[model samples]
Target: MQETGVKLSREIVTALVEDATAAPSMHNAQPWKFLFRPSDSVFQVYADLDRAMPHADPTTRALHLGCAAALFNLRVAAAHAGWEPVTRLLPDPADPRLLAEVALAGATAPENDLAPLYPAIHRRHTSRQPFTDEEIPRAVKDALSGAALIEGARLVFPDAWHVQTVLDLVGDAEGRDATEPAAAEELRNWTRVGAGAADAARDGVPDYAFGPRGRHGSAPVRDFAGQQSVPGRGTAVFEGTPQLAVLGTPGDRPKDWLRAGQAMERVLLQATLDGLATSLTSQALERPELRWTVRDPQSAMGFAQMVLRLGYGPSGPGTPRRPVDEVLDIE
Candidate 1:
């Protein structure tokens, strides 16, 4: 390997890690760790098992997705900082928790196509609010699809029938959660409530980020508040026909899930750059049976990884993230 001698300054690494931690996770768990090896000039991404939600994400698939999103962000940040990031996913089979390793090297030009996405890393947020009925331009959709294809995944904008079926499945998942108290409990534990906690705490979804109650709409937005009512949380009517996209990979293994996550983030950042607000609803995909049903048999997409809502809406408030020092270790 040609040594590029890229100086991984502490300030630069901290900025990269900060962008990495901004990735949205299942319930804002942010279940990931970063280790920087100055000697080898490599950054290792690991799954934080302690932060994993066993009840909701039994297979740890969601955890892998979160870590991979962070990995994708790190690559973009590196490229923006004028370094080329060479990433290897699942670099060690013996250490399953180690999701990825990225080596940063000095670059004469921007690394790959990630430099354009650096600004989106900070701009993109999971907008839970209702979107307008305005359609996303075909050109923008094609670009988003291309972003996924570049990352070795497929992005499918389901037909009307398929969209309806996905919405029903999400409703079914919500119903199941209502009956099974344990499922909702797990989500509640990760949510930060009250002004003080939302302002001071790091990690997890804050109360302010929980958009208004779904008074009338079939959009698969998860009711983070659940049955608990926020004192002044108003109600709003969401778009009847939401612009939805399903991200998938050819396989359903852990590595495949990570790929889907990378694709998801890439598509999201591209969308952000193109002036689109997005939110994710994995409610239907959370359950194995529902996950399979959520897939469109007509489409070539294999395994559904995430359901994304994209449109012209208010960009969501930025959620809290743990300090870089807390999630990243230098050696």
Candidate 2:
């Protein structure tokens, strides 16, 4: 009598939420929450404004990016579990904080494309360490761009000129962070320095994952440590020409940001599957003035949401995530 192949259960919701939280965010803040209503088999992804970095994400753009990244992971996890997730962004106009609504309907045919990325969900982490100067194959780049395209966004690999522009803008952002007390304070508030704290931290980037201080090469990696010295942290030379991809959308709105975030995680998961080390930076995008110039002039991408560095190198250690219990509330 049963027509549906899969049914939503509390256990399944728990597992899916766990996989979703593994997505990368600004400072690993994990600015997301999930509320599962088993009665309707719907999962509500909400923006946890408490986790928002006020100074760094004044408009909450980066916060939206992080939440949508988790949303993408949730879709992959659901598809892998043989459930088709019907998702809507900004579903409720009255509630600005509710980022997405995912209704799970049993699937006669699950999303094959998304199910393949399930394994990469937890495997993909923001690698802050130095990447080698190996050129990524054209095929890999095309796949990544295609991934973004399907998510209603564009992933553009910048030309050499645009790459240098990004580096310069990144440097500018750093310089501002150094001089601006608010920016410096925001960075300090989110990063864990001590061994005990970093070890016990449920969220935020830990000192151990900060990678070596950039003595040279100046890869686009954000120096989480800043001026605060980690006792054992050492300096290393990063890749000279960091391969950068700009993930953007035609319009810069809440929905567009959500799409960009989903596209971003899709690209990252694919990159991880392809065995590429990855790290992303919102430093330049943090500052409104610098954010505009991040996009390539010739590219059709209207706005740059995130700058990603991809190459062959260490995949970096896994960062901590808040427990599912802490982030998810079952109804």
Q: Which of the numbered candidates is closest to the native, going by highest TM-score?
A: 1
Q: Candidate 2: what lDDT? A: 0.90
Give candidate 2's error at residue 305 in angstroms. 0.4
TM-score of 1: 0.97
Q: How displaced is residue 137 in candidate 1, in Å?
A: 1.4
Off by over 4 Å in 1: 1-4, 108-111
Clashes (backbone N, CA, C under 3 Å), per candidate, total: 0, 0
Error of 2 at 42 (Å): 0.5
Model 2 lDDT per residue over 170-211, tens place: 999888888989988888888999999999999988998999
Q: RMSD of candidate 1 to the true fold?
A: 1.2
Residue-wise C-alpha lDDT for candidate 1, range 152-267, written one tens digit per residue: 99998988999999999999998988888888889889887788878886888998999999899888898889877676788999999998999999999999989999999999
Alpha carbon lDDT of each predicted model: 0.89, 0.90
What TM-score against the true fold does each predicted structure earn?
Answer: 0.97, 0.97
